[model samples]
Target: MLEHWSSSEVDPSIRLDYWRDVAHNWVDVQPLSPGDALEASWSLLRGENCFFGTKRSTAYEMRTSPRHVPPGEDMVVISLLEAGEMRLNAAPGEHQHATAGMLGLYAPRQEACYHWGEGARQTYVALPRSVVLAALGREPGNLLLTPQRCALAPALAAQLAHLGLLARQPGRVSAVEYAGLLDATRALALLTLRNLGRQGEAADLPDLEENLHAGRHAAALRFMEQHAHRQGLDAAVIARGAGCSRTRLYEAFAAQGQTVMGALRELRLQRARAFVEHSPRLHVGALSWRCGFADPSDFSKLFRARFGLSPTEWHRRVWMEPALRRGA
Candidate 1:
């Protein structure tokens, strides 16, 4: 859809070539342009009649009431911008110069024109009136812009890159692959709506919370890995790095149902035990200090409590390389 219309002031043409089974009456084509507007072409993809489009505004000025949508034709239009700025008039307040994010709504059958700053890249999604009413549980006029934070925005960026790549490829993709693309676009729409607080209430699955855990836990693990050598590394600092309260951080681990302190101690002692086992001559006391234990006696005591043997004894038993202990 990035085809440049002309080198001169010619505006890019709107190409809506795919219209076979739209599951609706006429789509009511609207140019959504201003007299001052230059280039404007939108690439279209339809999933079960829902439309996904990307448009670029080669504009460079402000406009007052540049366009409007009449109140009749039923459709919802959404906008996701890769970069650049635009001012949007909607409920709550006007959005100014938003980059790398999304803004969208039910079309509400009225002319709409945006005042954009220079050339801007935008992605659009069009949903049928029935779909919007089903999702919004209200009339088009009542369906205003809502605060939506889609995590899939990053994923959508990736999806766009993949689409661009496929289009650039030498040969036409198989029908199966094309079908997959359509399905993916729909999935992206549903995902975006879910992120934007448009979807029906979910049951609040804990597995869905996996991302939260992954985000926080990965950071915590990386921090612990990097500073495992420090004797002062503890729960509070890890919590700070993970951007979680100490109690919340503790609960995150506890959700996994693992004892945080116990896990930490085991990890340290496990490393110390491995070092001692691998190097037949590595000093036990030195290994203890290296793994962040301030004193070898405390390390040995914990090691015995954990493994039913002191660090040195455990090392001796494992260093013998018995066939049963070879996995160590």
Candidate 2:
């Protein structure tokens, strides 16, 4: 399960006293000194996972606004302007103003701040330096802003909205579910952020080249899908079949926020799941071997860890599905 924190039911004086530990159990929350920051973070998280910039009756101030986070520290904030005007000032004298239906990224690592207009209700998600680096796949601490016009902006905004609702109504969701949602949202945000960086940034591509690369990647994925059933299919074989070096293959898929090994595991587990879900009578030991595990015990452990159910138990549940029932 993904780990997460909800602001609801938190003590009013959270960071000041006993509530500090409260944040750590579910989320990481540390008030930054003038120059300290978590780094570029995911907007789907709040408090510890990310910082926030919203206004109450009095003006709310964030690390941005005439603040420079220096070289190493960073606090990347995502703001969804529900109903208000906000201005962000960044280095190189870049600034943005909001009117309606807009999403903004404020890089506080390099001298930036958000100015909340009068009576504005803006939701902010601050990500740490580590999260930003993970998403960008590079160290870019300055200002990286992608407005709502981008393809993934809408989805990010929607996720932010969902998270906002959860923060307001934390009781409705179980801690387990909340953790999963946070993980999903964070993963989605990273993927979107990476895509946004590449979109319209590369040289004009030949249609043929684009098609060719797409086909290659697709073929590689297809090959992995088929051979994921074979435990012997390691990175070396995949690289050879994909017609790329191990490093190149890794780089290509890593752009999609997935590693070579992770794809193989996910594909294997997924196919095995399909098999068991279809054949309820399949024994765990046999299914594990068939799914590429040399050891049945290891297979059971992994299956339980991945799907949160033992193979036998999972088969029972899988057969319970109406579609699989027809076969049963």
Candidate 3:
């Protein structure tokens, strides 16, 4: 299926809202400058296992927020920047830039923020994360594939640009041909990953059955990380978010010697630890509530058990140690 969207078709007052509606299928979008004239258009070609398209847009930011996190769309995006620039902050203190002609890779399942410059044009392919994992024999961490990093990047960029052209005339392509295109693109993508020395040979890659099983766990973990702070988060909610059965969820986590609820608690504690480290002035009771703990005392026990110190003790130690050392 091929679909097109244009900001010109909508009223000027609602163009940003319309763009948000369209882009929300993949990432939640917000304007960088409120009330700026947003101009954008794109055509998308969807096949059985992949989506290919090109988008040209003015300055805006797209993000993945915890509340906006959807259940399961385990996909990786490969973008071939044709013009302008992109800034990505995929994690705290980690920023990357991709200029025109660079190939960018990121997992939509993870939290990220993407910024596009004015008149940014890019041809992109979104494929199931499992497919890319199988192709690379492992997960591809987010990065830009510069011509220097991967000799095949230039060729891959050209192929992606051609995909955008094909998307413009989707009716002329038959289903079988579309499938073939995806297969070929997957092959090229694999080469790019390997060329960057991301993984070993095809023989080292996990078999199809194992990759499918692990993919479920990976998807579930992604969901857990995003929603760990919710008070009612439980096994059933996680299973639903992962798009898997409760039994499957249990099996997936058990394979790593972890339990559903146990994992959730650990995630919460980890989040709490981060809060303690960053905001030592925050009361432990308030921090406990923010991290989904019902009782501040219980939260302190868990925090101490996990980190060898109560939240208050840990916070004081972390913040005061430098001062103490400086005095010494």
RMSD of each: 22.0, 19.2, 16.4
CA deviation > 4 Å runs, candidate 2: 1-57, 60-73, 90-94, 137-149, 200-328
Clashing pairs in 3: none
Error of 1 at 90 (Å): 10
TM-score leader:
3
Q: After superposition, how far is residue 312 of candidate 2 from its true place, in Å?
A: 79
**lDDT tens string, model 1, 1-328?**
2222222333233222221112113223222222222444345555566655555545433222213233443466555665566644311112233555535443535433344544676665567667655654554431222242334455655665456445444256764675578677656765665554443233122365666765665566666666666788789887887798788777666554444555567568767766866786757678877998988888889988755578767766655546455666
Q: Can you rank all candidates by TM-score, best first?
A: 3, 2, 1
Question: Can you give the TM-score per candidate against the true fold?
Answer: 0.40, 0.41, 0.54
TM-score of 1: 0.40
Greater-lDDT candidate between 1 and 3: 3
Instruction: Report the number of backbone clashes for model 1.
Output: 10
Best by lDDT: 3
Higher-ranked by TM-score: 2 or 3: 3
Worst 10 residues of 3 by lDDT: 89-98
